[model samples]
Target: MEQVPLNPSRYPTVDYEEVMNSDEGVRKWTDNIYRWGFSLVDGSPATPEATEKLLERIAFIRHTHYGGFWDFTSDLSMKDMAYTTQELGAHTDTTYFTEPAGLQMFHVLSHTGGSGGASLLVDGFAAAQTLYREDPDAYNSLKTVLVNAHASGNEDVCIQPAAPFPILSHHPVTKELCRVQWNIEDRAARMDVDAATLVKWYDAARKFNEVLKRESMERWFQLKPGSPMIFDNWRMLHGRSEFTGKRRVCGAYINRDDFISRYLLLNKGREEVLGKI
Candidate 1:
């Protein structure tokens, strides 16, 4: 069965204060993130400290080379393109890691002297499902073919997963669709597969990319201070529109294990919460 594409507008925003104080609010907020793969928090304190606190409210931040709680702007301090004033296509973060960050939070502190910079989010699960129904061969190719990715912009540092991973991954125990890893910008040029298989994989990847960019599958919105967004990195691809001004953003990553433990505990004994991830 094809999963319905996510529409952030349909979900209600939960107040940060309520979430921090009430169990019911926490349930609603967590449920929104699990079901829709994302949630927006209202009435949050607009500061880097507040952003860190809000993320810690859910789970401890997973510290990476980028650091635990980031407050960055378009200064090119980092080697990645995210620090540049350019358009970034929809892609999941930490693709080069053996275990990618599970959840990502974003709080746009400020944006000035720019007209564009609307956020781009696409439901990768929905896009994959659509491709399965429309082109099974392409879907299967993505499911079976292994691809490599790397992060090597840093002068003396480089990162890549120990082994290549397929675009579609299923949980070993549950055999359920657990991840959708797709990042054209991060994909490595050297693939381990034969030329014939690599050709098929590229063709499949193109088709999958097309599906991901479909208008119906994309949710576009502008980020504002005091309103933060938490999204599942495993199920959604996030990006931004090109802009020419300074933009300050702060956020952090939450480990998959920590997030799942928190979710299961918050909704403990409520088997209904065990819906398809």
Candidate 2:
């Protein structure tokens, strides 16, 4: 795979300037993203321009129903809890969409006042592995059972119908862990499987959620302004703690394939050394 799995003890950080300026920066940052499914870019300019410029390094920003790139805060108009002070549980975004976002990038424009709103991320692959080893039966159910998800109430912004996807999905060929679809808020009733066995799937989901929430499995960090966080939407579950005062963030999503394609092209030569390993 040529990817280094994450070591939870140490946080991963890359230089924003380096990624925007140097070729080696592109290789290093992309490699880290491939390895960890997430990476932090420190020392970014606290401006909208920085966010746009940064995304360009990988590919064009993905224009979805949410718009290409936008800034969001405690705006009452938002249809989602993310715009409010509520603490969000660890979950993946856009689970209702058949082709959900592939990569998401966030640049904290500002975070002030009461001490909270720290970012939370759980390694889905790691959590899935834990489930496989500890409760193979539950893991099997999650890997095969289809769950329903829906998105609506934002008017023309989004009115997606409920979609079905296995909670534990893998790469079509590699059989590698791909995405963990776990969103409590967007989850609808499960009607994809036989009613008699539905309870078993729910039990598996509960156990998976328990593993995801285990204190040791989560990574929490206060992403203050000038710090940009980019993560694989498919491989990592993200959420935030409740906070007071102003907290604004600007970000966007890039198509998953585009991001992967860019990385493969930029790091093509470097693989010879990795191949030797």
lDDT of 2 by residue, 1-277 (tens): 3333346335677888899899788778877787888888878898988889888898899886667887888885667887788899999988888887888987889877766888998888889998999999999899888877877657765545445788888889998778888888888775667865798988899999999999977888788688888999898999999888888889998888888777877788657646754
The sequence of per-residue lDDT tens digits that candidate 1 reaches over residues 1-277 is: 3344455565547899988887777777877788778888999988999889878877899998787899999888989988888999999999899999999999999888877888888888888889989999999898888889998888877899999998999888887778999888888988888989889888999999898888888888787899998999999999999987888999999998888877776876346556534
Against the true structure, what is each candidate's TM-score? 0.93, 0.91
Clashes of 1: 0
Give the poorly placed runs of model 2, Cα more than 4 Å off: 1-10, 157-163, 270-277
Compute the lDDT of residue 121 as modeled in candidate 2: 89
lDDT of each: 0.86, 0.83
Model 2: worst 10 consecutive residues (lDDT sum):
1-10
